[model samples]
Target: MASLIDNNSNVCSMEEEIEAEAAVLKQIQNRLAEKMEVGKTAPPTEEEQKEIDARSIFIGNVEFGATVEELEDHFKGCGEIVRTTIPKDKLTKKQKNYAFIEFESSDSVENAMVMNGSTFRERQIVVTSKRTNKPGMGAQRGRGGIRGGIRGRRGGQQTVVVKYVYVNGAAPRGRGGFRGGRGRFNPY
Candidate 1:
């Protein structure tokens, strides 16, 4: 009967030990979660991402020496900042002269946009709404397509380019270098 009492005491002590260890583990986990949130960025949920996007501003011509703290201080008057992202060159780890600042409210975004062309760290920064790279959107294709030459292929000369595409005879590919094939044959 004494041995049975001792066994019950041992089991109770073991249960208490397990509960103590679990409590310690839970505390550790909570501390680690706080550290992770402070030091590392976690991927935002879809709605959170959209909220961020809508409340963000694109800042162009940002000085290379600018830091997150400086940016937050500068825009603090606008509203509470959720994040500020300055893209860096992966190879050199240097700022790429641009940044994205996300605020906690649309009013903050408006206030930031009002600072467009304001001088920041000796550069005239362009502040605008954050733009996404959707097709048929953002900056247009820029002057665009097919280099013809210094003078370019004249409108009337397009036929010459079309005619030589399927020439069957011994055309011999004149002007074969950078000047390209087939000198304009006047054949008058």
Candidate 2:
């Protein structure tokens, strides 16, 4: 009889432990469901939603001193201005010579493209699709380890060479083995 009572007690303890575990599991599931419902039902604010829904247009080659207000004023002729932003330098806190202008509709962006190649602040402006690349992504990180290694092995174009030939086209001679030697006002 004592053995039978011990067996019954053990069974009851085991059953109680299982019931406690089940209760804990049920609570966890309830909390997860509540969190999911909150995430699904609570929508973003109007301003945030508008930012997400609005189209993005790139305004490149802007002046370094251009202000957000100035950008808005200039592009206002295109259409109903949604927002104008000029990315600032991380350390210097100055404009980075580029901007983004979002308009109320696609037509506004289309109209703004006409302003491309026009001079703003004495610098020619470039308008196109907003760069989709994430900020702070550098060439070192952009190329994976293997590709980066291969690129490192194959030396890339020298900055001075590229600037002289492609960009400025007036290569300073003598030092870089460029022909015609150094001239004061060399055009070609």
Candidate 3:
């Protein structure tokens, strides 16, 4: 008799088990639907987006050989220099021709822009408010590349230089592998 009772208690029929689970799931779904009625959290306000958009001053046309120290020295007199960055080439590890400089205040940044467009060194400095470097940057150049090599339809060349390129990856047929110099990866 004890064995019979134990066996009956141990086994719940599949239909009953499924019904129990379905009921619990229904409750959870209802709760989730009710919560969703509160609506998605409103998107961030314009002011918040502006704060996100507001970036540090970006300095371009930097002399390629210029170091971080030289950049600081050149711009320090303009205002409190917060940070300076000179990006290096990916493979060569040498300085790229551009840099980014952050000032302590926006006012100082504005002043620096006014004081520094086409300012002479070896070449004229192209100083302006820092903007995202994107494909459109060349369009702003008015001709073609940075120097506006191509002429636009308006008789005067559009300074904007838009360069479009496409690359195809075709694996080499011979024993020469994709990565010859880099050896196998070993993590200790």
Per-candidate local distance difference test = 0.77, 0.71, 0.65
What's the best-to-worst order under TM-score? 1, 2, 3
Better of 1 and 2 by TM-score: 1
**Candidate 1, which segments miss by more than 4 Å at Cα?**
1-48, 135-188
- Model 1 root-mean-square deviation: 11.0
Estimate, for each residue in 1-188, the C-alpha lDDT of model 3 and write its tens digit.
Answer: 99997777667566679899999999999999999978777765766534422435666778787788877777776788777888898999988878877777777777677656655457667676775444444544433333424433444333443443434754334332232313344342
Worst 10 residues of 3 by lDDT: 174-183
Per-residue CA lDDT of candidate 1, range 1-188, in tens? Answer: 99999999999999999999999999999999998889777787767767778899999999999998988888889999988999999999888999999888888989999899989898899999885444454432212222333234333223223334435755544454234433564434
Residues 36-126, candidate 2, lDDT per residue (tens digit)? 8885756667665555434557888898888888788877888888778888889988879789887778778778888889888888999
Better structure of 1 and 2 per lDDT? 1
| Top candidate, metric lDDT | 1
Error of 1 at 3 (Å): 39
Q: Which candidate number has the best TM-score?
A: 1
| Deviating ranges (above 4 Å) for candidate 3 | 1-55, 118-121, 132-188
Q: Model 2 clash tally? A: 0
Q: TM-scores of all models?
A: 0.53, 0.47, 0.42
Q: For model 2, where is the 10-residue window of minimal lDDT? A: 142-151
Return whichever of 1 and 3 wins on TM-score. Answer: 1
